[model samples]
Target: MEILIMLAILSTVLGGWGGLNQTQMRKVLAYSSIAHMGWTVIIALINPNLMILSLMIYIMTTLTLFMTLNLSSTTKIKSISNLWNKSTPMTMIIFLTLLSLGGLPPLTGFMPKWLILQELIINNNPTMAIVMALSALLSLFFYMRIIYVSSLTMFPTNNNLKHHWFFTQTKTTNMI
Candidate 1:
């Protein structure tokens, strides 16, 4: 039990701090996955069922994020700054997906983390819960960075590149 708790704490800390210097979008997402998996492992020590549920939610949200990034052809942090010019709706979806991954309320991503935290407290492990929560805040910083770069910044106007006028496809057939 002590080993499991220590590993969980270590995983949480590493996950939060690992992506701070990452410029590649894929590497950032990988670190985020590691941090989320830490949460799942922590809960799994007490209850395997909840861990499975959390894993499933994490998988779904991550799939949505990666698929969106793939479709946008964004592979690096610098490229994400121009995402708003390429597809406004997809940019919005990406923002929401990032928020959800950060475990914000009213989103599917919040459910598993919330439940796991509650379980931790109920199991008389408030210290681990607090550590996990603080680590989550750290992870939120990078998630916000991705969101800000992808949706908040304006495209560079100095370039003479002709903008393509793509008809907005209401149905995201590829997403299915």
Candidate 2:
């Protein structure tokens, strides 16, 4: 149990810290997963059911975030900065998804964390619970950064293209 607790803390630190310098959305997600793993490890120790629930919520939120990036054919954070014009609704989804992944309140992502934190507290591990809560703040920072970049800030775009680079291409196949 001690080893697992140490591992959980390490995972949380590494994932949250590593994501701080990421310029690519995928890398951020990867780091976020690492941090989330730490939470799950601890949650698993206290309540296996909550672990599964957290994992499921994480999976769903991640899939949505990834799909937004994939559908936009973007990787770097800068690439997504101008996505507001391409699709307003997608930008919104990415925004909500990122928040949910960060475990923000009123979002589906917060449910597992809330329950897990409660479980940890009820189990008499207030110290570890506090650590997990602080780590969540770290995760929230990067998630908010992405949201700001993707939605709040706008990069100057060239007027030459009517659509994004990915959507501008036309592939034609001949039927034989």
Candidate 3:
């Protein structure tokens, strides 16, 4: 149990810090998964029943985020910059989904973390709870960067290509 807890903490810290310098969206997601997995593992160590709950939430949040990235065929951070220009709604989805992925308040993603933190405190493990919360904050920094890129960036008129990614999005396709 001790070893597993350490691994979980290590994963959370590494994932939080590793993504700070990443350029590829996939890599960032991968790190996010690592951190999330750590959270799951930590819950398993302390409260085995909650592990399933955490995993389920992680899967849901990750799936939505990946779907949005897929919508834009997003690869590099630069690729995300033009997503808003093409589809405003998709861009909005990406923004909200990313926030949820970061475990901000009032999102599906925050539910599990909140439960886990509460569990930890109930178990008399405030230190672990603090670390987990801090790691979430660290991860949020990178998510905000992605959100900023997607929301504010646009294709420069002087692009080497004559036409930018053809604006296939005639109308903001209503999200299902």
Clashing pairs in 3: none
Q: Estimate the overall C-alpha local distance difference test score of candidate 2.
A: 0.85
Cα TM-score per model: 0.85, 0.86, 0.84
Compare the candidates by TM-score and give the number of the best one: 2
lDDT of 2 by residue, 15-87 (tens): 9889988998889989999999999898888788889988988888888888888998878888776777786
Which 10 consecutive residues of model 3 have the lowest summed lDDT?
Answer: 159-168
Indicate the residue-level lDDT of 172 in model 1: 81
Residue 135, candidate 2: C-alpha displacement in angstroms? 0.6
Which residues of candidate 2, in runs, are more than 4 Å off?
156-176
Best by lDDT: 2
Candidate 1 regions exceeding 4 Å error are 156-176
lDDT of 2 at 173: 30
lDDT of 2 at 167: 38
